[model samples]
Target: MTDFSGLQQLTSLIRNIEAQMEGAKLMILTHEHREEIARHMVEGLVGPSREHKVRIETSSGEYMNQLAILEIGGNKYTFSKDHQGMFISEINYYTCRITPNSHGILVYHQDYPGVIHDVSRVLAENKINISSMNVSREQKGKSALLVSLTDEEIPQSLLSRLQQLPQVQQVLSLQ
Candidate 1:
C-alpha cells in the first residue's frame, strides 16, 4: 500500500492557496497509481458543496526519481524521494529541497544584494529565529525564491511587514 500521510498536508496547502481563486484545477502526474493518488487528492481538496470549482487530472510520465508532479494554477511543485528522505523538491519553477511539516515563510522577490538582509532585518526585529534557509533563482538579477524555516510561528503582521519590503513581490507563510 502507498503511504498517503503526506498527501493530506499537500492537499491542505493547495486548498489554502486556491481558496480565493474560482474554478481551480489540480493536475497530478505520477509514474504509477495515478487513479489512487487522484482520488486521495480529490478527497482532500473538495467538499460536497464545492466540488464543481475544482478539477483534477492524472497522467503517467517519467519525472525525476518517479515522484508525483502536482500543478496548481500555473505553478508546479514536486514531491521527491531520495536517500535522505522525501522532500518538496520544486516550487513554482524554482528548485528547492523542503522537508514535510516545515514551518516557515516563502518569499518571492527580485534577486539582488541586500534583499536577504532586509528580510532578515524584519525577522530579527520580530524575534523570529530562522532555523534554516534556502534560496534559488533561475538567473542573476531575476525573480528568486527564498524559503526560511523558522523556530516559531510567523505572525500575519510579520508577513505583512515582509510584504511591504521593496524587494519582495509576494510572501506566503507555511505551517
Candidate 2:
C-alpha cells in the first residue's frame, strides 16, 4: 500500500505539536480535488458535523506542476509529486523535502556547530543507528530541520533527552 497523503502527514504533525484544530480553519489551493481533499481532511480531524469550520478554496489558475498548497491556522505547507515521489516540500516558511513514509526523527533546531554531533552522540549512546540524514536550513545560524532515517526505532526517553539538548527546539519521532 502507498503511504498516507501529505494532508495526513500535516494532520499528524499538527496533532504531534498539539495544535488546536477544533475551531481552526484550513484553506487548500490546488489544481484538482480541492473540495474532496479538504472535506476528507477536515472531517477526519473534527468529524463531519464540524467540517464547516474549515474553509476550502481553490486557486483560479493551476499550479505550474503537480502541487497543492495547504494553509491552516497561520502556517502554510506545500505538497508536490515528482519522479522522486511525493514530498512535503515546504513547512511554514522553512523549505524541506520530506517524504511521508520517512522513518526516524525530525529535529527542528538552531543551525549551529555541534548540534548534529550532539544528536548523533545521543543516538549512538542509545544504540540507535542512522541509515541516512538530510539537513535543511533557511540561512546560516538560523532555524534548521534535520531528517534522520534510523536503522531502528528511537525510544521515547531518548526523544525527550534529545529535546532537552541545547539549541534543540523540537524533536519528533516518526515510523
Which candidate number maximizes TM-score? 1
Where does candidate 2 stray beyond 4 Å? 1-6, 43-52, 151-153
Point out the worst 10-residue segment of candidate 2 by lDDT. 1-10
How high is the CA lDDT of each candidate model? Answer: 0.73, 0.69
Pairs with steric clashes in candidate 2: none
Which digits, one per residue and each the tens of the lDDT, describe model 2 over residues 31-66? 466666665556545555742565565666456543
Model 1: how far is 120 from its true place, Å?
A: 2.2
lDDT string for model 1 (99-170, tens) is 656678889999999999999899999899988888999899999999888888899999999999988999
Give lDDT: candidate 2, residue 123: 94
Candidate 1 structure, TM-score to reference: 0.80
Cα RMSD for predicted model 2:
3.5
- Residue 103 local lDDT, model 1: 73
Worst 10 residues of 1 by lDDT: 45-54
Model 1 stretches astray by more than 4 angstroms: 21-23, 47-54
